[model samples]
Target: MTAPDPAGEAAAALGADRALRAAARHSAGRLTALSVSSVAAAGAALAEPALLGHTLDLLLRQDPAGARWTGWCAAVIAAEVLLDAATARLTGGVDARSTARLRRLGLGRLLRTAPHHAARHSPGELSARLTTHATAAGGVPAAAVSAAVALLPPLGGLVALFLVDVWTALAFLAGLPLLAILLRTFARASGASVSRYQEVQLAMAGRLVEVLAGARTIAAAGTAEREQARVLERLPELGAEGRRTWRIYGATMARTSALMPLLLYVVLGVGGIRLAAGALGVGGLLAAVRYAGLAAGVGAVTGRLAAVVRGRSAARRTAVLFGLPELAQGDARLPEDGPGTLELRGVRVVRAGTVLLHDIDLRVPGGTTAAVVGRSGSGKTTLAAVAGRLTACDGGRVLLDGVPLEDLSAEELRREVGHAFERPALFGEDVAAAIAFGGGPPPGAPAVRAAARAAGADDFVRRLPRGYGTALRDAPVSGGELQRLGLARAFCRAGRLLVLDDAMSSLDTLTAREVERALLRDVRPGTRLVIAHRVSSAARADLVVWLDAGRVRATGTHTELWRDPAYRAVFGDAADPDREAAGRARAEPSSRPDPGAVLPSVPEPPGREAVR
Candidate 1:
């Protein structure tokens, strides 16, 4: 684990406390019931010793009421047993519901936050927080209730002992300070150890997940053994922390074990003296000793306190996720038939104190394409992300059709702006469903097929074992094929604006050319912002925006900017042949299809327009 930040931990602890309170309130009804049952059980336990003692006295005195008193004693014992059972049942229900509530809140917040914020935690650490940490946090409500109720038995026992005989009560009271010291020490030591254990566990889990994601690379590189060793580097620390937690617990229990009997013996001796002195009767002496034993049994609360400490520690880890800032949305809608004009005004993006995009100002006319070209680290992807509102710019504003992007409602914004990245995560039952998955309802079969064809994905999809119905897991797709499917998904929900962030980089030259043609011809007319590394893509665009070192270097048609050597060097020597050919071809571009040509319109899907 990395060095702990005291301020961050303090803040996290405060948030965790708030989250735990919310969870408690969520299951308040059940927790209240649990508390009632626990109190009832304690009452029965306290009444049993006194009732039994009275019955013994009655029997010793040869009274006829002895039998009835004995029956009462049995009833009290039975009630305590039944109440304990009810308490256990209620505890389970409270734990389950509280855990479910915590998981739901965490997941909802994660989904609502910006993607970059969510990416701060690894998959394994997130899993641990949502599963194990959530479970521990969920148990806090019940454990806290139990711990509070647990105090009643000892306190009631002490009161009963005082009623029977002051000397007996005094003996038990003498041990109180020692028990308090033990418990305080246990809580302090256990909390620190449990927190360290959980931190190491999270680190190990994160390393394991990171290794698993790169397992193929490790295997190919013949470094699997080294990676395995790296993942387990912290195993010794984890074990040490766990042992320290248990050792603290064991030491507390051992001290309590040694102390309880000594106090009980002292109470017994004092009670015997009272009986001999005629200050207490036989039954009173019996009741006094039993109550003394009960009072001295305060150590029982140690386990409950320990559980609460563990849960509170785990809550701190899970509560960190709740601190992620959710992206704020608005209530405005885009204007009807606005031609999908997109404009960036003085836009700037900063991450980790480094500028990703600075002072970017550009506009793409309605129903036209603008290709953004730059070197690998020059902010092309950042500009694409800003245009689509994937990440809000730190400074300035972006507007789609004269309305600020932030002003649009989430539903309206998602329905109007579609994006496809180089590596898209497909989520659906089958290939067709994956393509149809978007902001709107699933498109019909014809629409799905049209989009697949438009993205040049239909041919390979048809060869799958079950065609469009093939299960996603059963259909192993190549990188280029995956990119096509991602494109198809974007096409199936063609909107006012489409942003493609190097979405065609994985495809071969001919395939990329065909998909580009289909994008303009078969997809709906809209503003297209393509982040390009290929010369041919820039050459075909109506305008090109060249970015350099987080700033816009130039803005013009590809032919107009080709004269600059700096612009040519962006593609490098590997692309020089294609650059020259594309330049020559764009200079005499009457051979390509008409830019204004319109294809036959396909039936639009419900809730959004479809690819034509």
Candidate 2:
């Protein structure tokens, strides 16, 4: 399946407010523990300063209470400072474990998604989500809980002030509405900008990966400058967005700064006049000012809360990244460990409205060799593919040892049948490893040497710096050499069915003939299917099957087909001029052979393919 739309992914990450809440719940126990300590610390911190103010006020008037208040103030200050440090440490530890659990769940979901889901997204984009997004989301518990914790002490202080003087509490309450407006404006506006910045960060990561991967292509095309320009252009846009977020945050903070001091001035100025006029005591005025200072920390908490909301946006994006799955549903059935006879029953392959192979009913009976012959486009390769089950047939069943191919698991089929194509692809591993790649060396040196010798690669491989042990990077091997190694790997597989899909096409005719002879001489007596262009190679097989326009036009020994006009028409008249002369050389009898022996008595056309 193609990837779900990017918009859906973006929407999911952005809309996972529920996931964020769920994560919070997971962290709740820890958060509560930390909050308890944090609130206690905050109360201690507030108490010491209040006591200090009391001690100073008493000292100024030389009251006897001054001596008692001084000792209490000194002791309380030390305990409050120690508790605040301890709570901060506790909060840090709890957040670490919560982030780790969230990471595991998100990553596990992604691993379950299908392979096509992975193919649709870039490695860079996925990495960005895991790294950048996960990092942001991981802080959710601490930020949300810390804001609440920080707000508590100030709230408690405000209540104390309310009890001391109603007019001072009223003055502080007046600033609350304006302060709220500023924080709301900052959070709303900056939320969008921070989200934008997070997106750009992901894009930048993706772009960096792309640039590194395509460095060679970019250099060859002289496109480095253009790519640099594109990156440069995007950077400023991100920078500008970041600036906007900062300004909004700063604006919110500015209002809190202005309001805190204004409340203090209004309370002190009014309370001083009231005290002088005998409406309140000097001690009460001092306490009211100290409480007002404690309330000011609310602004910092509000700013942190806003940043946390934005960080969570990143976390949600990363979680979606971890949700994508890789790969498809593979076949699950197993092979019976019996005859690996491969058969294509009335199969036709069609592509782009053109028939590639039609009604190709061919079989490689167990412990037999069969060859498919045709022109370049006459379906020789396609017939070989059907027998190997590399490409699926559009019509009819391909059976392995009488079992339908699809019913057998892919691993089972591969285990039973192996193929060597005209072109072979090797991984970035070294030469010796690629040769042994179909699996490890075939149990012993004899098996590995025989397989390599059969492919005519053992000689050249031995001449390399370290022979079979040579690293691929240390020596240069041509494509033809790689093809030989691929064949060696296929031979080493030792499956019941071996398929050579024009595998010898890369070698010269002499070398190809040498390899062919060695293959027949050494490979196990398994059912073999050879797709060949040269008639001589096809003639070596026990049965020769000819494909023309996706159909089996002829099937017989080479000499028998030489006399048939349809076969003659396709391959041209035998150039030997003397049928007897060629017959004597081949030592094949000049009598009509049993047709049913080599092929299933030429399939009739009325059903699917018309026998000529």
Candidate 3:
């Protein structure tokens, strides 16, 4: 979900061939209508000069053709006006619909991708893709159709001039190569400029979004100016690229403006000579002059080309989101009575040529809690993610209840595996709604309330202004409360395997213990994987997995592992006195052995003390 290679994007937009083809597929009908109308209008416009010339001839000769030709000219003008109106309506509709479709598609892809892949994209970048890029690219169909139709007027005028006088047509044709060269140069320069402008704009926008999201931090640190400077670091590049685009546009227009009149004047002079030499009539001369003007006017085509260039640049950015690869899923279903046993075989995760998890082989029995403990960057979270199937490992086979996690259908996987994160995205109409946001048959009111209670969120919910009806956006809750609400949401889904990745990090000891008890008692029996940073959480778990530097260093009951100096050091425990104090704090009135208690020695495995 990261931004695509700049070179690849440039290739995609260089000719805008791919974007044009996509636009045609999505809005071909509207584009075709616009093109047909443009052609009709151009034809009507081409007839104007010839008809007026004929009228002038009739007036000079005192013939009746004048009235009829004048009336025909008025009809053609009326038809041209109507066609233009239709073209405008169609263009507006195409632009709106295509932009909407692009936004919807981009968001859908972002949501459906793996969490790790999605993290590679920033909110600001995605927002730019959904809005600015989509809107700009939406104009591609109109610009392409207009550019195609623009050629008709000049070509038709040249034909009419040739029929009237060969010398004038030849004179108009002679100046075309210069205009072509100018347009080609403008396109190449403007395309590169527009592409760079969009890139810089995206960078600035992304930085701004991040700053806005962290406004409280910046204000607390009193670094408003510093943050602002950082956010605007790319402003100069954006401005330079923007100005370059305009400069190219202006230069193209200036050259066309200077050349157009000279071309027309030369053709007119040739037409006058033909008339004076008895090779052409006065009416023929008039028609030739008008045709020369039409043939030389390159303004409309230039505008359409500019639009095409901008639209292509934007479309390339939008296309990156559309082309992101989706995680693969299968259609197999889990057995109804399957135990939620989790296993990882030869699990390896390599990112940017660095191993995050190496040859991880671990398993958790169904109906037990396994706490994965490690220092920072020790791959505990990665293990939790892989176990829950949130992300697939590079070289591994993960089986949930004897079924390969990847072999399960998406719906089945989501329904069978649940996850609670450290910081959850809880956006809903109200508190109750936020806690019930997940798959599986929608939780009933009773189920929602029960889940909230199980996660220790009920007391805070009742204190809110509207209780469960209070809007999440309006409620001013603390970090612990927010974490509990996220936990409640996860609890609502009756998944067979639940992964809590530092989900209760913000909770106090008593509250976390209560939630843990509630989870064990209320929820259906299932496997639980807890990524823990606290020694107390590991002490409460059925088994502890100690990971060091992307490899599992030890696995056993917390009581068994506590004897190791390395294991004690994971919790920053060193001296015997500090260990005793921590043990006293964790030792509550429970049947389980106290942290400091000397329990009877159990048989320890020979190699690395693995209990699995």
Candidate 4:
């Protein structure tokens, strides 16, 4: 195995730090308030012991001024309590705002990245990063401020000790080295454990998400128990890590708990000696002991430091999303009324050192349909993706209407190009909203119905309880119905170019043919790049581009390619029966029309004209 790159690791750590700083800055105002309040609270806490001791001394001497000192002591205590409350409030605000900022940044990057790049992270992993990891990262600003402010009480108490009695102060100073050693050790060990714990949590979360997505499959296969075992494969590791973190924390607190009282007692003993020598008063000795206790309260500091360490580790995980390379959009726009002519020059795509598509050159003129036919893994989907700039070509360039895809602004590119996937995701409030969802202003109700009709989705949609207004979650659509909605969505925004990547695979042949007919006659006319598996789809296209392996093997009319047995074998047994009939007709040349001829049209589905 190759050795790890130390330089790359260091750079990633640095990037994580920078991401954390940016998140902190997003809530700078509230963090500043939290810091100020924390410092003020620490100051008040430090002053309390001295004020109470003075009041006690005055009361013992029968001084009338003792009442005033007690009142002042109460006021100081009240101020400390109020300041701490304010700090808590400020910390909440900072955390909320910072978390929101981190989530927005991460989500924006996820959405802006090319689809293939974004798929590098699993849905569960992405969800964990944006939710739990973002929450932890967001708390960093408050934690850092509080940790810094936590130093004030200890340092002030040390100074206050000296002012009370030099001997007591020196006694407290003697134990400072031990406290420093404890904090350093806790920080180092706790950080490693926390990081390991978070990593395990992320792994489990990713597995759980995978299981959820495949729950139905697992249930059907009667592998629920097996899948559950797989999902929780790391549960023991997670538990171990959790125990390790707590053990470190418990160990550090136990050490601090043991050391603090010893130091306090040493100061107390020294104060007693001073009192015996007439060098310290009872009130002064009392103050000295309190100061020493305050100075040795390293446990509070350790807890705060632990928060900082955990936040830093979580920040690293959350920062990964921000590192995704976004698909950059240029400032240029397409020419007005330009035909959706698409041209690919030496287009190539590679992932994990394996070529998915390579050296592909093709052009489809505006107002035509081109079907990409290939066996499994033949680069058809990749070609469809490249056509609409869903994924950038690694080797060459793709142009739409003479403008390089990379040169078009995001708004311009999305507005001019559309896509429907085999399993398209429907996103919106209801059925109508989902159909109308696309770049630019949403299509109005009439346009939505027309598009739905063209995709043969109107009849079923109208049969629903609330028709177009039905909630998506409430509309129990099948796979084919879902595909129709996706096609409808694409049709509603059909522009200069539309890419359908096996978008009709789930539909029955009758519905698929009807949708195809409407696509040609009723939908907005544009260039269509269809990634097809069924022979009928290829036959209906104006042109067919056959892919073999990662290269374009042939480009012609489906009829022309049909004469080649190798080309016919691509569809295998799944070839349409009509295509078989056409093939038989071709074999008996004198009996029937050419096999390449368009199949006879079927009657339009009923109620198709109502939507029109």
The deviation in Å at residue 499 for candidate 2 is: 14
Q: Candidate 4 — which residues are off by over 4 angstroms?
A: 1-5, 573-576, 580-612
Q: What is the C-alpha lDDT profile of model 3 across 204-304, one tens digit per residue? A: 88888999999999999999999999998888888898888999999999999999998888998998899989999888999999888778756569999
Give the local distance difference test score of model 1: 0.88
Which lDDT tens digits does candidate 4 get at residues 435-515?
Answer: 999878878999999999999999999999999999999999999999999999999988878999999999988888899
**Residue 277, candidate 1: C-alpha displacement in angstroms:** 3.8
RMSD of 3: 5.4
Q: How many residue pairs clash in model 2?
A: 13
In every candidate, how many clashes are there? 0, 13, 0, 0
Candidate 4 at residue 13, lDDT?
75
Better of 1 and 2 by TM-score: 1
Please provide, for model 1 over 1-612, each residue's C-alpha lDDT reduced to its tens digit, 9 standing for 90 to 100: 378899998999998998899899999999999999999999998998899789999999999999999889988999999999999999999999999988988988898887888888999999999999999999999999999999998999999999888888988899889899999999999999999999999989998999999989999999999999999999999999999999999999999988999999998898889899999889998898888778876899999999899999999999988998978779999999988888888899998899999878776777767889989999988899899988889999999999999999999999999999999999999999999997657689999999999999999999999999999999999999999999999988889899999999999888988998899888988888999888888888776788999998887767767779899888884376576657575577432222221221111211324347
- The best-first sequence of candidates by lDDT reads 1, 4, 3, 2
Highest-scoring model, lDDT: 1
How much is the lDDT of residue 78 in candidate 4?
A: 99
Report the lDDT of model 4 for residue 162: 92
lDDT of 2 by residue, 1-612 (tens): 255578876677655665566667777777777788788778786675467667777998999989988889878777778777877786677667666666766666665453335545677877777666766776777777778888876787788678767888787778877877877777778877887887787777778787888898999999999988765667987899889888887877787888888988887887787678876677778877878777766787876787587767777676665445432225755455555566788898886578898776776556556777765689887777767766667789887777776676656667777889888766436555665565323235566677888888898899999887777778688878878888887776757788898888778666776887777667765677888665556556666787777788877766666566666455443334333433552675533334465454322111111111
